[model samples]
Target: MFLFEKAVTGSRKYWIWIVCLFAVIGAGFLAYLRQLQEGLGITGLSRDVTWGLYISQFTFLVGVAASAVMVVLPYYLHDFKAFAKVTILGEFLAISAVTMCALFIFVDMGQPTRVLNVLLHPTPNSMMFWDMLSLGGYLMLNAVIALTTLHAEQKGIAPPRWLKPIILLSIPWAISIHTVTAFLYAGLPGRSFWLTAIMAPRFLASAFASGPALLILLCMAIGRLTKSSGLREPVQKLAVIVTYAMILNVFFVLMELFTAFYSQIPEHMEHFHYLFAGLDGRTALVPWMWTSAILAVASLALLIPPGTRKNPKVLAAACGMVFLSLWIDKGLGLIVGGFVPSPLGAVTEYAPTLPEAAIALAIWAIGILMITVFYKIALAVRESLA
Candidate 1:
């Protein structure tokens, strides 16, 4: 009861942030309600561009949540003292991020209420069910593990000897959530572009890069605005990890393009054509496509220079660009682009309507708000313990 109460009564600033966050979310809620009343017709989704921004965000965030394991495995399993101070925060961030991912999907669905239909009447053959199961399981695992670890720390007791296995289990489970998410795209028999074996590896690489980039940016924000010492060494180490992951992400994308063009598969080439060339100027996603490329190159340039990576200002700029680049590349481009010139050879485009955008904005605001409130509680808890 004490712990529960403590969690609720956060600082005044925390409540202020919460109110602002909810104001944005409430606006989005009104927008989502409009969508629910009207139907998916309110958004830009047609038969061709079925999965739009919401689904794309769900995919990207799953990877972010999974990457929390990178911090956890090192600090907890391997006993890396460098990460000892910041790993708990990473765990909490993961929780908030995953919650947002779930909400985004809920809002995207045609029948938000019927979501239980997935469980009430399980589909043994559908990949969607497996995805729901994995995501739910992973969220529970992260929450339980993180809270138990924090509880142990507060009491100055070592984590339970047996909980180590659960932690170990979470590592692969983390990989599975994103893999299942990729499979959600890749498994569609008609979409030749996403049907490749390389999709899972590509997902892993991009997730690793984008996840750490966000963590680094978060650390920078903490250092600048607050009295926190910030995560210096661990942030640097994670940046190195991001660098390697970025290279792999670029390589996998190149390999995929090469394989498609080399194979001379007309079905495969069609998707790329829609993305790059634009089908009859009707499906012109050209601006987004080019912007993604430029951002990717710029991010790599900023990250590769040791001087730039270490400097707070430069690192923050690079991290921001990298984060946006991944959102455009994976969240918007990859998902929507794949469905263009869809199986029927008809070109369709997607642009979120005001309501859709509002709902999405609300969901994002809610996530930031949750992080702020939780962090306030965490800070107060730490000070009390000390």
Candidate 2:
């Protein structure tokens, strides 16, 4: 019943997937070695664009990790039966996502060995320290709750009564993780794009949408692969949650636009102009930004109609569209767009180098591998009970 032993006993297809992930991870490791030897010059980061793809990904994955609470709240606090079957899966997904967030931060630090300085020389005034604390604490909370719950289930015993309090604590902790992350950008003095009062709410709304959409897809895939029957109702319920969250996310985006353009402040307007239409002939991100907007609208159209949202195939596609749209909006667009015309009023463009991309791929591969192993163990336990 050991987790690793159970994980190694997965079917042929699972092992094949693991092998492919390892291959990508290996290549990335080699690329990281080169980066360590040569320093951060291997990345697309420049004096103007200091935070590149790594920070962007870290920001995105933090939202993904915090999304676990949507399921946890209804299942544990409200005692909702619809979320019963997949609560463990959500927690395990959070674990993998938080792991990715931590790894992305580690790799972004050119001197990986000096990461201890964040802890050793604690800066109480810095938001980065608070971010580290929130993510690390959330990771521990999820891991402990998930493993204990699974272990109790395998033994046909209820989880300890005392654990309920800790579960409740995680609800606010989940909100705090992304809120603190937004504060990291929002509090910056010169970053006009992220200085909005709504940044934290926007982050939470988008996280709720993207995180649950991903969970729905994963649930569907697991049910198909495992030949299970109970996921249909849960997946349908999740789709509704995703729809509402996506609506709020889109609303937040529009609110941001209205405030920026209506106010007509050159500092605030420039960031929006640069992201959507390009500034001074720097049109690199305009295409991607528009594509994200179009996809968001299309996905909303599909999600709003109860009939289409209830159809499994349609739901899946809409979930995918929403996920991709948010990834482009928050993942690629948000981080890079904030620095479009830099703080000093100079236009500079940044694109990830091959090695940087490889490293990012490796981190993602590692996260997927972790999820696979965790789910394998959970599935084996469930099958044994059945």
Candidate 3:
């Protein structure tokens, strides 16, 4: 009832955007049901492309979720004045992004409805179950932290002393969410590419890079769209964060390459080959891979220049390019590349079916819609306070 009341009476734009979000989610649900009824056959997922768009989104959003820590760390721990105004907004964004991360996993599962089965009958040995637990716990923690802080602010009173520990606890919990998600990939047995020891580090590096970049982009968007000053100094600080993270991300990727080639393990070498060299005659992914590489280079190149970094438009474009590049690399390229030259030493490829693509689009729409509505409400509340 509270959520409903907030939804309808919130704002015309908010309600309209939510309607669009629901429409898309409904379409995705219909598609999901069709897949459920027909089995995984309806989706582009086969043994080969077992981890498709949905999993890709899950990976990407973990980075998005972790990015909130960037804001929280500076604002709360370091006592940065620049982020004071926007730290709560960052937390809310994390909440919504993490929610979508969970939903994406649900939609991707063969039996999404049976997700509760893990809770009903705990599987201590399963990485998946651990993932579920960690994600759920992190989500609750973030929601509690964000809401309580907001409630305190709204009442024009200090947040309860107890909430400090809870908010502090969420910092580790945030990192754990992304780490566990990376474990989901790295723990798999035969996927040599994903099984690397560096996988988790790479995951964190990319998460830090892309996640902060997205937040910076979102902050800039908010400033332009709503005429809000909205943490420009902190955003610049975050850009510095992304610059270092990108360097590390590139370093890790190169490290992955070094290990694969130097070890001369055919099993490991083959996967990297597919990513960079296009296994067999399949060159479709090659261009995308290069695009990611070049863009990463360009992003770091542009961001390091002082004059260019300070310009909002230039900085925004660089962030956007890095974000899109990482999206392609993590979402499409990594998942698809891992499965090539299947575990059995055979070649297979996967292309998404119409239903699968539609479902993917719908999930993304829902995330955007959530962001839009939440921001709208938050802006109104901030305005009232002002």
Candidate 4:
């Protein structure tokens, strides 16, 4: 069936949502133009703290995109029937997210043409080279898997045998994308905040938690709107995945704290202090970090117990807390914590300027647009089949 059948068939509400996204995208494009003309100086970035909102978001979303494996693995490898319906949604989400990741990298480059440098030079020693390969490969894999499976389902036929190897390939491909992303930071010399052996595991843990938490919320919203989520069992199962992953994420963080404090390494300890208790009286991130802590604890309370997590309303709240908490900690705090206390012991802070925020918003709007259209198309096909 043609995508024109359902991708374009949306109610007034859907049309309004798409229009609003375009409005945001248009505004973002204007702000991006300003940044392009003025360069990185327009944003809060400085010589000391070079990376800011863009890199932070890129870091966080990498995990979200990688989380698709949580769904794909269970359904394909373990044959978990509960995840069958939600797997394609996860794939579509990966596609939208990786697209945003690439855009974030694009805008962060003062000269957009710099992307060609990476593409053309092909440095084997650079972590960035591998990161690009991982992300690019994963994006194509998910896109192919999702589109092929959906096409098959619309016609009520099994996906071709050739697709199985590709599906299996995506499971590890998803992991490589985030692992390489973590290495991008960890491999950097003198960045005490990101230098650690467990960085990849930390990234994976948070990705699994935040990604599935988002999927749960998306499935719930879709279910409410169409009255046919085809994801009730899958959503519940995903809550279980979120619970354990969140636990591991928290544990991994605690392990980092021990390594920093126990070893009494001032360089390492300073980053955590800067995040939670600010150094040199610059407390910009202190409040946000604390808020993330509070929300993390509250979410754990809501999710740890079977009784509370099983409640639809309660689960929704818990998932919201999980998503926001990780956003602040991983998306915003991690990047700042790493850059502050620059190599020479100068403590600099970073925040997004108006244009910077707009550009970020625009990227988010683009992702949402992709997801909205993809979901609409998927739902329409499934409904027709029913």
lDDT of each: 0.83, 0.93, 0.82, 0.93
Find the 10 residues in a row with the least total lDDT in model 3: 1-10
Cα TM-score per model: 0.95, 0.99, 0.94, 0.99
Worst lDDT 10-window in candidate 2? 1-10
Give model 2's TM-score versus the native structure: 0.99
Model 1: residue 106 alpha-carbon error in angstroms: 1.3
Q: Quote model 3's TM-score.
A: 0.94
lDDT of 1 by residue, 20-43 (tens): 888999999888878889998998
In Å, residue 199's CA in model 3 sits off its true spot by 1.2
**Residue clash pairs of candidate 4:** none
lDDT of 3 by residue, 1-386 (tens): 32323434655665676788788888888988898898878877787668888888888888888778888887778888888767777887788888888888887877777878988999888878988888888878888887777777767788899988888888888788888888888988888988977877788888888988888888887887776765688888888988888889999998988888998999999877877787787666777889999999999889989889898889999999889889988988888888988988766767789888878888788778777766666666676678
Q: RMSD in angstroms, candidate 3?
A: 1.9
The better candidate by lDDT, 1 or 4, is 4
Which pairs in model 3 have colliding backbones? Answer: none
Model 2: per-residue Cα lDDT over 7-100, one tens digit each: 8886789889999999999999999999999999999999888998999999999999999999999999889998988899999999999999
**In terms of TM-score, which candidate is stronger, 3 or 4?**
4
